[model samples]
Target: MQYSIGELAHRTGLTVKAVRFYSDRGLVPPSGRNAAGQRRYDDAALARLDVIRVLRDLGIDLATIRRVIEGETTVAEVAAEHVAAVEAQIGVLHRRRAVLNAVANRSQPEEASLAHQRLLLSEVERQCLIGDFLADALGDRPELAGIARTLTPELPGDPSPEQVQAWTELAALMRDTDFRANLRRLVDAHEGGLRRDLAAEVRDAVTPALVAGIGPKSPAARAIVDGLGRDPGELREWLDAVSDPRRERYLELLGVINGWAAPESMAPAFGWLAEVMAA
Candidate 1:
């Protein structure tokens, strides 16, 4: 049986304008024309319109829906492709929502909110930031190249608020050109044989002193320096350069991003070492 555009729309539960649009887009063709040149459709047109509606509701764009309706591709193929696309979009929205909730939890100022937002980098950006930083710092040195990868931080799949904040701060630090240059200089200086593992060794040995709350210039700091087998004067200079508050902050941030345990402060131990050398 033949039906006019309005009748077809009424039967299909679609707006007349939508049905007309589908017709214009060639998704649903008219079976014939009425006496006054109005479009009339048959059962085939109704069926085609139903398919278009279903596809559109499934988040398929009109272009793909048209392809499906035209049999250019199978419905199953199109549906599968759209499902994957929808899933990806859902993942993005989920991450964004997590970030917004974290911002709300802190009740940060507008500037802080913007700063956090700027750090919401995609996976590629995160990798590039870390890769470039390590490459610039340790790429030429064969000995340190492997260590660079070991120090890299990978964010968790479901990151916590702390992780989000840490990542934001780390991203900011990585982007600072001067900070990058300084880090490079520090790495290059350490390439000298005398203090190759000085930072790591200090972090390990001085952690005990820091835990004990010894001051930087205290006599007790001498014990920590002696334990590391370094001369007090040389140890003090290394501590001054390597025990940067910012570097400690960076590791703290890295732990947050990676969901690792928070590392203990090495500042106290270094403080004690510095003081011992001065004395």
Candidate 2:
């Protein structure tokens, strides 16, 4: 039996335009022309159209479809390959969804909207993102490499859900203008021959004073402050440089990304010691 374009479209449950599109692609070509020169197809074209429909519904691309049509490969081979591809895509989608869910549970980060694209970055791309951030933050001064290392967030190859969320937040923090400026100040202090970590020393000294019930303005608190070898007035400058809330939060996220234990906060100690120094 012979079928006109409209007749073939009606029988195959396709729009006339879709039927013409396949015909133009030569997936279903005309068997002959009618007397008036309208295209007519036979059962063979209809059979080919059915094959095309099934493959299209399975999400196979036309290039792959053409291979099947031209006998370059078998339908079974295509289905098997497509099945694996589909399964792999599904796994990726699930992971992406979980990462988004993790982001949603936290306070909305500054670049929360771009979190998905950031998560899609490969390891090399991820490294480049931090590298660019460090270059922008610390400049090209190679002498400051040690300080840059302390700021880098190293997300592991196989990260936990928590780690992924932490990296997302940390990446957003890296873009913060004020946070970058604060980091620059830290670099200046380090380069100005204050390579010692005054913040760490103060936090360590004040932690003991805090547990021992020594008041921040008490003589014992002053004793702990003096023990750190920092002049009473200079601790405040280090505190201002290092104790930005965002800076502390960045360190918390860094710990999560690098698989370190949650860090005890330095804020209480910094505040206490700063108060002690003032006293």
Candidate 3:
């Protein structure tokens, strides 16, 4: 028995346009033409249309449908490959959702709206971008390289929302030119070991005085500095350079990214010591 395009569409519960489209794609070509040149289909054509409908509903593309119809590939092979592609797509969507959730929780700007961020940044690209900043800031200082690696944020395959947010903020912080120059200065001071050693000495000496409420410019604070056995001039210079607020913020953001305990800011103590030197 033969059916015209309209009859085939009605029998199969598909639109006439959809049936015609399938015919154009040759997925369900008509068996023959009627006397007036209208297309007509036999039972085999109807069966092919049924298969095409099922495959299209399953998210199979028309090219793959053609391959299956031609016996060039099995339905099972195409479906399996499609399943893998769907799973990868799902993974990307989940990450994007997590990033959006994080942004919402923090009330961040809409510039990182989910679709835009997903398209712009991948985890590998994110890491590579930060790696570029680190290389530029640290130069070839061997002593600071280990610190640089430890400071690098490694996002997990399945990261928590907080990790996503932390990574976003850290990326922003690293992109600041002034932040990069400040970090380079901090690293240079650290490379010499003198700045760190001096800071440690002053902290050890003055933390007790600071805790006791001895004012920084008071005689007792000066006495504490006098006992540290370092040149007050060198210590004062280090204090002035490293007391930048951005430096403290960088550490805070680093702690968030690495899941470390927030390190206590020594800015107050350093500021007090700087005051004593000025006096």
Candidate 4:
């Protein structure tokens, strides 16, 4: 049986003009003209129209839909390809949202406005930029290469907004000359674990004093410092090297990107050590 274009449109919930356009495009051709010389569609055309409607709803372009109707491609093939395309688009959108959140979290709102230029970086590019900074900062300290690797940030395939923001700000921090110098100084101080050893001793001896609220120049602090048996000059040099705000922020951002537990700040202990040296 044949149905007029009007009847087919009414049944399919498509406008009459839409049905005509599809017929003209040969996607749903008329079977034959009716007695009134109007377009009429057979059951086959009606069924094909149903498919076109579904494919269009799924965001499949008209050309691909036409291929499906023409039997040039299988519906399953088209659907699978479309699904992959849609997932890729969603991934892009996810990354874009992460970038936006990173910019918004900046304390300086103007930084966010300026961040759009850097938002085009891919994950590999991000890693490369960070690696270059680490290489330059660490210099030829082959012994400290492992430390450099640990400090490097790797963005996961699906990162949180906080992670993205941390990475972005960290990248900016890496470009600062003072920040680079501070890191190199700290790295140079690591003579066969000398830096770590002193830090461990300081933490152990001075932690109790800190807890007791002993002032840095107090007699109790002096006793702790002397008992630790570290050279005051070396202690001063180490504190001067590592006790930088950007250095601390770099470690914080590393933790953020790696999902590591927040590191305890040694700034207070270092500040106390500096005071003991002055005494």
List the candidates' TM-scores in order. 0.70, 0.57, 0.61, 0.62
Q: What ranges in model 3 sit over 4 Å off? A: 1-92, 104-120, 192-197
Give each model's whole-structure lDDT: 0.75, 0.79, 0.77, 0.81
Candidate 4 ranges beyond 4 A from true positions: 1-93, 101-109
lDDT tens digits by residue: candidate 3, 1-279: 999999989888899999999999788988899899999999988888887888989988899999998899998999889887887677667767776666666554665574345333765677678888888778766767777877777655456777676666677777788878877776666665545566577668878888899987788887888887666666665676678787777778778767788978788788888888889
RMSD of 2: 7.0
Ranking by TM-score: 1, 4, 3, 2
Model 2: residue 92 alpha-carbon error in angstroms? 7.6
Backbone clashes for every candidate come to 4, 0, 0, 0
lDDT of 1: 0.75
Candidate 3: 10-residue stretch with minimal lDDT: 111-120
Model 3, TM vs. native: 0.61
- lDDT string, candidate 1, 71-188, tens digits: 7998999878777677757766766766776777775498566756665667677788888877775667777867786668887656677777777788777777766665665675
- Between candidates 3 and 4, the lDDT winner: 4
Candidate 4 colliding pairs:
none
- Candidate 4 local lDDT, 232-266, one digit each (tens): 66667777987787888888999998999998888
Off by over 4 Å in 2: 1-114, 121-125, 231-233
Q: Give every collision pair in model 1.
A: 216-271, 216-272, 216-275, 217-275
Clashing pairs in 3: none
TM-score of 2: 0.57
Whole-model alpha-carbon lDDT for candidate 2 = 0.79
Q: What TM-score would candidate 4 get against the native? A: 0.62
